[model samples]
Every structure is written in structure tokens, then in C-alpha cells.
Target: MKPAAFDYHAPATANEAVALLADLGDEAKIIAGGQSLVPMLALRLAVFDHLVDLRRLDELGGIEARGDSVWIGAGTTHAAVGRSAEIRRDIPLLHRATPLIGHFQIRNRGTLGGAIAHADAAGEYPVAALTLDARMHTLSPRGTRDIAAADYFTGMWSTAMEPDELLTGVTFPVWRGRTGFAIEEFARRAGDFAMAGATVAVRLDADSRIEQVALGLFGLAPTPLRATTTESEVLGRPAADIDPAEVGRSATAALNAVPADIHGSAEFRRRIGAVMVARAWARAVEEASND
Candidate 1:
């Protein structure tokens, strides 16, 4: 099916893009890389009257290490992010999770900002941001504002963004000492939209005990969920004392009701999610201690 006709505006600057969005209001959609949005348009599921293309905006694409954080521009392609030296050096979790997004072709076309803007609960970037406590910068013709990742996602396919807002970039804080991060997922097949996935971030103390743990999950709820329940139980515990199986069991405590579809039952998804969480946690912890 052909998409409904729409006006397209390719803007060269962030300010111009924001202005286009403000003028188009609710009728406008932002296109970067066209990974997710293009599909929606082809299926006739989305009916945007205008599209403000950000691909030409030089200001929105790049990856660099700032003073305290690695700043990833909104327009950076997932493939670029997957191979970024900065991302691999400062945050392996982001690098590990990027390949899980889709096939090479899709990753080549998918923009980081597009994923966040789409706000898919099962998407990779959302969980990464949530677990990292990254900061998101959004701009509108009115002005610019920064929002914490913890507060940015309101629901599945929903965000704190106003109608005219454009997400410009994300800032993930650099960790101190030796840090270990791991990502694991359970899907019907490799590269499939993960039926369930989990990301674990572990920071060790001088003694190498678990100092801070952030567990984030996708396809476990309405939004990329931060698993504080599992985190609270893991902190300050020796790696030997915590069973990998026990951490997996804690997944059930963090997630109760997951969406049930043909891919799997809600109950089954919760079980798989738990197992993945445990594996990722143990893997991260092991890497942290060996260093």
C-alpha cells in the first residue's frame, strides 16, 4: 500500500528543523535515517502531513567523548555507534546492544535519535539510556531543555516530548574505575526484535564487590523498564554469594505482567527475561573482577 501524500522539508540545521516542526505542529514528523518511520509510512499505519528531515542537519550527527560523558549525536547511525571507538572504550554496553537491534542493512539506516523518538519498548537504545541514566537534549522553536532518561520515556511509543520537540543528542556519563557491562537477549531467532532482552551495568568497589547495579529490560512492560527490584537485592553482595540462577529468579520479581503475543506467552517471556538478566549480570560481574 502506498503512503498518503506528505510534504517533505530537509533542513540543514537543528534550529531550522525545530522551526519546521513548530510550524507544522502535530502534522509534522521528524525523519532521521528513516529506519522505523519509513516502514510505518509504507504500511499506511502513519499519516503525517509533513516530514522535517534532519538527515541534512550536520549539527545532529557525530559521536565524541566530552569531559564527563560520551556524547552521541541524535543522527548517528546504529552501525556507526556499533563500531565507535568512543562507545567501545567508554561504554561497552552500548556497543554490545547495538548489533541486537536489526540486520546490518537496518542498522545502516537506523538512527539513534529515530529509535528514541519512536520510543519502542523493545528497542535497544531505550534500555541503554535508561540503565546508563543518560541525559537527553530536546529542542523546540521555543527553546532547548535537557531531560533525564529516567523521566524521558512516558510509555510505549510515547515520550515527554512536546509536539514540536526534536531530540538532539544523548549524554551517557563515563564510569570510574573498572566497569563491566553486558547485554543478552532471548528471541525466536537472532536479530529478531527481541522477545525479551536485558542490559546489566556493574561498578565495582576497591574490594570488587558489587557497588552499583543497573538492570534494564525491554519487552517486559509498557516502556524500557528499570529493574530496581532486582538491583536492590544484588548490591553489596559478593559475586560468589549471588547465584546466577538466583538473579534470574529475581527477574520475576522485577517484571510481573508482560505482553502476550504469538511469539510467546506473557508467563514464558517473564521466565526468559529472568534467565537473560542473570546471564548478563554474571557475565558483567566476571569481567569486572578479572580486571
Candidate 2:
């Protein structure tokens, strides 16, 4: 089915786009790459009276280093992100998660900001962002605001962003010390949305003690989640003393809202989620140990 009749808008600048949204009110929606929105629109799952296109806004499309973090413009495509050497070197988790987003054709047209804003629990980028504690930047008539990744995702396909706000970019902190990152997910087929997934980041001290770690779980909850309980359990423990399987169990044990559908029941998803956490934890520790 085709999308219902709606007015198309191409704004030359972000300020203009937000202005249009502010004027259009709740009836308007922002369109970046349209990889996700197009499907929703075609299916009549989402209807917008006006679409403020950001395609012409060159300001929202670039990658740059900012102090100890990398800032990726919201309009940057997934393929562009995967091709970026800086992203691969500085933020390996994000780079690694890029190829798992549907197919090459989808990635070619999918934008980083769109993925995060769409806020799918199974999306690789959302889980990666949560794992890295990335910061989201937004613009509105009121001015610019920064939202932490932990607080950014509020519910299913919902965010803290106001209707008039435009997501401008994301800032991912660069880990400087001996660090390792890995993401693991279980999907029925290649390029399918994961049933459950985990993204792990670990920084180890010289003596093989865990200095810092993050376990971000996706496809197991309504929103991308951080396994804080499990992280706290192994925070200062020696790498050899911690068991990945135990950590996985602890991570999923605290989850209360794992989704259940035809693909899998909540209990089944938790089981898969635990395994993903365990696998990701093992790989991440191995890399950190080698470093």
C-alpha cells in the first residue's frame, strides 16, 4: 500500500526544518534516509501530514573528532559509518554493528540518527550506543540540548525528543586504555533482526583486573537496556575469577520486560539473551586480555 497523501518539504538547514516542525505541530515528521519510516508509512503503521526532509541539509552529514569523543552527524548513512576508518579504529563496536543492519541496500539508505530515533530494541546501533554511553545532540527552537544514551530511549520507538526537536548528531567517547569491544546476536537468518543480542565493552587494568565494563542488551526488552546488575557484580573482580556464563545469567535475571512474540517467548528470549551476553563477554575479555 502507498502512503497516504502528505506534503513533502525540503529544508536547506536544520533550523528551517525544526521551524517547519514547530509550525506543523504533531502532524509533521522528520525524514532523513527514510529506510525505516518509508516502510512504516507504506504499511500505514505511521501517518504524517507533512514530511520535513533533511536531505539538503549538508550540516547534518559528517564525521569528526571532538576532544576524546567522535561526533557523527545524524544524517550520516550506515554505509558511510561502516566505511569510516576513524569509526572502525576509535569505536569498533559501532563499526562492527553497522554491517548487521539489514542488507547493503538498506544500509546504503539508513542513517545513524534515524536508527537511534526509531529506537528499535533489536537494532544494533541503539544497543551499541547504549553500551558506549553515547550522547545525543538535538536542536529545537528553544536551543540545543544533549541527552545521555541511558535516558534517551524511553519506550518502544519513543524517545525523550520533543516533536519540534531535531537530532543533530551523536557523540561516542573513545576508550583510551587497554579496552575491547564485541557484539553478539542470534538471528534466524543473516541480515534478520536479532531475537536477542548483547554488546560488551571492557577495560582491563595491567594486572588483568576489570577496571570498567558495560553490557548492553537488546532485543530482550522494550527499550535497549544496560545490564547494570551484572556489571556491578564483576566491576573490580579479576578477569579469571569472573565466569561469562554466570554473568550472562545475572544480566538476564533482573530483566522484567522481555518481549514475547511468535519468534520467541519471553523466557526463550531471556535464555537467548543470556547466551549472547556470555558469548560477547568471553570475546571481549579475550581481546582485552590480549591487549
Candidate 3:
């Protein structure tokens, strides 16, 4: 199906893009990469009077390491992030998860900001962002602000972004301690969106005891969720002693609702989520031990 007729505007700057959004309001949608948005538009799942393209915005097209953090422009492609030495060095979780996003063609055209803005519950970027505790920067006619990863995603395919705001970039703080990361996901095929997934990052003390751990669960709830309960159980425990199955149960216990669709039942998704969490935790533990 073809998308409804809409006006298109290519903004050379973020200011111009936000200004266009301010004028068009809810009628305008900002598009970058066009991986997620274009498909939705084509399916008529989303209807907009105008599309404000951010591809030409120079201010939103670079990757840089700033002090203790890595700043990735919203317009940067997934493929670029996956291959970036700086990203792999500063934020290995993101680097490791980028390849799981989609096939090569999709990653080459998918933007970090677009994926986060789309906020698909099954998106790998959201899981990585949550596990890394990333922050999102945004601009609007009124002003600019930073949104914490925990607060950024409000629902499935929904975010805190206002109609007139534009996502400018994402900032991820470099892990300070000895850290290990792993992302485990299950899909019908290599490039398919994960049916369930877990993104895990663990920081260990010199003694090999877990100091800090984060587990982000995807495709099992309305929004990406941090397995805080599971982290609590794993913290301070020796990597070898941490039980992945128990951690999985703890994480799922905190979730009040499990999503069910034509793809799977509520119970099935919950079980899959548990398995993903277990696999991710085990791999993360192994990696941390080696580090």
C-alpha cells in the first residue's frame, strides 16, 4: 500500500526541522533514515500531512566521544554505530546490539533517533539504550531538554517527545569499572524483529563479585523494562554463583502484564522472555569473569 499524499520538507538544520514541526504540529512527522516511519506511513498506520526530513541536517550527523561520554547524532546510521571503533570502545553494549537490529540494508538506513522515537517494544536500540542508561536530547521551538532513558519510553511505539520536538542526539556514559555485556534475542529468522530479548551489562569488582548489573527486557511488555528485581538478586553475588534461571524468574515477577498477540500468547512470551534473560545473564557473567 502507498502512503497517503503528504508534503515533504528537507530541513538543513535541526532548528528548521523543529520550526516546521511547530508550524505543522501533529500534522507533521519528522523522518530520519525512513526505516521505521516510512513503513508505517506506507501501511497507513500513521497519517501525517507533512514529513520533515532530517537527513540533510548537518548538526545531526556525526559521532563523537566527549569527555567521559559518547554522543551519537540522531541521524547516525545503525551500520555506522556497529562499525565505529569509538562506539565499540566506549559502549560495547550498543556496538554488540546494533548488528541484531535488522539486515545490512535496514541497518544502513536506520537511524538511532528514528528507532528510539519509534519506540517499538521489540527494537534492539531501546533495549541497548535502557541497559546503558543513555539519555536523549531534544529540541523544540520552546527550548531543548534531556530525557533519561528510564523516562524516555512511555509505551510501545510511543515516547515522551512532544509533537513539536525533534530528537537531536543520544548520550551514553562510558562504563567506568570492569564491565561485560551481552544481548540475547529470539526471532523466527536472522533479521526478524525479536520475539523476546534481553540486553545485559554487568560491572564486576576485582574479586569477581557483581558490583552493578542492568537487564533490559524487550518484546514482553508495553514498554522496554529494566529487570530491577533481577539485578537486585544478582548484585554482590559471585558470577559463578549467579543462577540465570532464578534471575529470569525474578525479572518476570516484576512485570504486571505480559503481551500476547497473533505471534504468541501471554504465557509463551513470558517464558521466552525468561529464557532470553537467562541466556543473556549467563553470557554476561561469563564475559565479566573473563574480563
TM-score of each: 0.97, 0.99, 0.97
Ranking by TM-score: 2, 3, 1
Candidate ordering by lDDT (highest first): 2, 3, 1
Lowest lDDT sum, 10 consecutive residues, model 3, at 252-261
Clashes of each: 0, 0, 0
Model 2: which ten-residue window has the lowest total lDDT? 254-263
Model 2 agreement with the true structure over 1-291: per-residue lDDT tens digits:
999999999999999999999999999999999999999999999999999999898999999999999999999999999999999999999999999999999999899999999999999999999999999999999999999999999999999999999999999999978898999999989999999999999999988899999999999988999999888999989998999999899999989888898888999999999999999999999999988
lDDT scores of the candidates, listed in order:
0.88, 0.95, 0.89
lDDT of 3 by residue, 55-148 (tens): 8987887899999999999999999999999998889889989988889999999999899998998999988998889999999999999999
Off by over 4 Å in 1: none
Report model 3's TM-score to 2 decimal places. 0.97
The per-residue C-alpha lDDT of model 3 at residue 193 equals: 87
* Candidate 1 local Cα displacement, residue 117, angstroms: 1.4
Report the number of backbone clashes for model 1. Answer: 0
